[model samples]
Target: MPELENNFYNKNLKPLARNMRNDSTKAEIRLWCEILSGKRMLGYGFRRQRPVGNYIADFLCKELMLIVEVDGYSHNFKMEEDVKRDAQLQALGFTTLRFSDREVMQDIENVWRTLEFWIFEGENSLS
Candidate 1:
């Protein structure tokens, strides 16, 4: 993973990211508490509401150069923005995986399985 530099850090966005962390959405809270927090996922670490470049990633794993986005209803109208955000993250050497609120809220186990496969296996194959 590329080291984060001053150019990538936007001071203004930190506060927003911190605020989002404190007042997390239901799906974000659930995903964090249940699956991603506490150095989980084969010892990989994840940060919630992490500021990456100009956008804040829902969940970021620096070691794996991965960003997991948990999309809610608002995302329905933001396909173009999401595509741009993914491209920006990809330019910074991160691959993003997006999941829906219903998927996370209803079948988190399958989400976990997909994440596990992506992180530990699929990413390697892609490389």
Candidate 2:
């Protein structure tokens, strides 16, 4: 994977990304505050609503080249679009993990465990 450069961040999307950060959904807020904020997830730093390429990722850990998305009801109608977007991100060297809003809101511990396990596996692969 190539190193992320300034060009990887779409400057045109900055305002939209900022708006998303400020107007985060309840699930997004919970995920960020409880699990991902302040390098809390195995000390991996995550940025919310970070602009990457042409899209703004919900949560991005640049070091891991990972993006986590909290999909709401609307996402059910956009599965194909989501899949394409994930593929595009993957092409850019990112691994995207997605969770439904209900999973994040009602079963937060599971979400945390899933993320922890993924990180653990990734670290082991490096070894």
Candidate 3:
């Protein structure tokens, strides 16, 4: 049935994998998991490379419309592309936040604090 197939397809949309193999995105993910384990994270789950519109975002919480990007050395070569994608996401009512790999790895606590505050700010603004 078409309905059954649709349901099955939706169920298969697993955003992130737990045990990352050769992903260069692992460091940011590990730091995020540590932050999440500490209850520093809010409604947004750490979704690795979630596809939104035509862009594949690093981490996106669909419910909150919040996108988190952990920029690495590679991103330096794609600033213009990133900016265009970010503009499209913003137009779709999503707020994008970016943190560098060094920032997340060397200053994790601050990253957590900033992420928490942003999430809370989103919540508070809604009411």
Counted clashes in each candidate structure: 0, 0, 0
C-alpha displacement of 62 in model 1, angstroms? 0.6
In model 1, what lDDT does residue 119 have?
76
Clashing pairs in 2: none
Q: Show the colliding residue pairs in model 3.
A: none
| Residue range 27-118, candidate 3, lDDT tens digits | 56666577643444764555555556666666666657778888889889999998998898897778899989998888888888888888
* lDDT tens digits, residue span 60-114, model 2: 9989989999999999999999999999999888999999999999999999999
Best by lDDT: 2
The deviation in Å at residue 18 for candidate 1 is 0.7
Question: What's the TM-score of each model vs. the native?
Answer: 0.90, 0.96, 0.73
Q: In angstroms, how far off is 67's CA in candidate 1?
A: 0.5
C-alpha lDDT values of all predictions: 0.87, 0.94, 0.69
Q: Could you tell me the lDDT of residue 127 within candidate 2?
A: 100
Q: Rank the candidates by TM-score, best first.
A: 2, 1, 3
Candidate 1 clash figure, as a count: 0
Q: Which regions of candidate 1 deviate over 4 angstroms?
A: 5-7, 122-127
Best by TM-score: 2
RMSD of model 1, in Å? 2.1
Which of candidates 2 and 3 is the stronger one according to TM-score?
2
